[model samples]
Target: KYQRAATCLTKDREALLAFYDFPADHWDHLRTSNPIESVFVTVRHRTVRTKGALSQKTARLMVYKLVQAAAKGWRRLKGANQLPMVTEGVKFTDGVIDAKNRAA
Candidate 1:
């Protein structure tokens, strides 16, 4: 039963372990990251409560406003400053920049 799951994980081992290539400060965020789920939870609750009362357009508008409002209270990522380094192709190993691979 678990063999398939284990095989899938083994097949994608490199990608799964790629998390460690990010900044150590971001580990917690990476581990628990689910911004879409968190943001949509309120939307789902409110929409379900409304049942069929809302038109399709109204539902979209409400979801948009809800997400906009949620964005205001969202927490910023830790080690956000390292984002540029990462984007610039900086090499990280075990959550720290690899000095040997660093560009001058």
Candidate 2:
């Protein structure tokens, strides 16, 4: 089902297809990045709700506070009940922070 949907998007959505710059680098990770982009989208959405075009300072403040508050609970869940890291294919660094030192 996912393959069929991706094929359809590749054929139809020019905007979405432009995201596939390096097809080799973690396609599933790229898909996960999409939701992060929505945070910026939410900022744009709130910005346009103003009666006139927002002042630069005002826009920056709005985005800053929104992102800060959004990040509040984000970190707590990440390290909680964490599982062992799994690497795949050419990126099998076995959770090593410094890739150069790993037995690749």
lDDT winner among the candidates?
Answer: 1
Q: Write the per-residue lDDT of candidate 2 for residues 43-104, one digit (tens) a residue.
A: 67776786544588886788898777666644332322212322232222222223642454
> CA shift at 69, candidate 2, in angstroms?
2.1
- Among residues 3 or more apart in sequence or in different chains, the pairs in candidate 1 whose N, CA or C atoms overlap within 3 Å are none
lDDT of 1 by residue, 17-99 (tens): 99998889889888875887888897888778877545889878888998998899888899999989889888899999898
| Residue 40 Cα positional deviation in candidate 1, in Å, after optimal superposition | 1.4
Which parts of model 1 are misplaced by more than 4 Å?
1-11, 101-103
Whole-model Cα lDDT per candidate? 0.86, 0.53
Worst 10 residues of 2 by lDDT: 79-88
Q: For residue 64, what is the lDDT in candidate 1? A: 92
Measured by TM-score, the strongest candidate is: 1
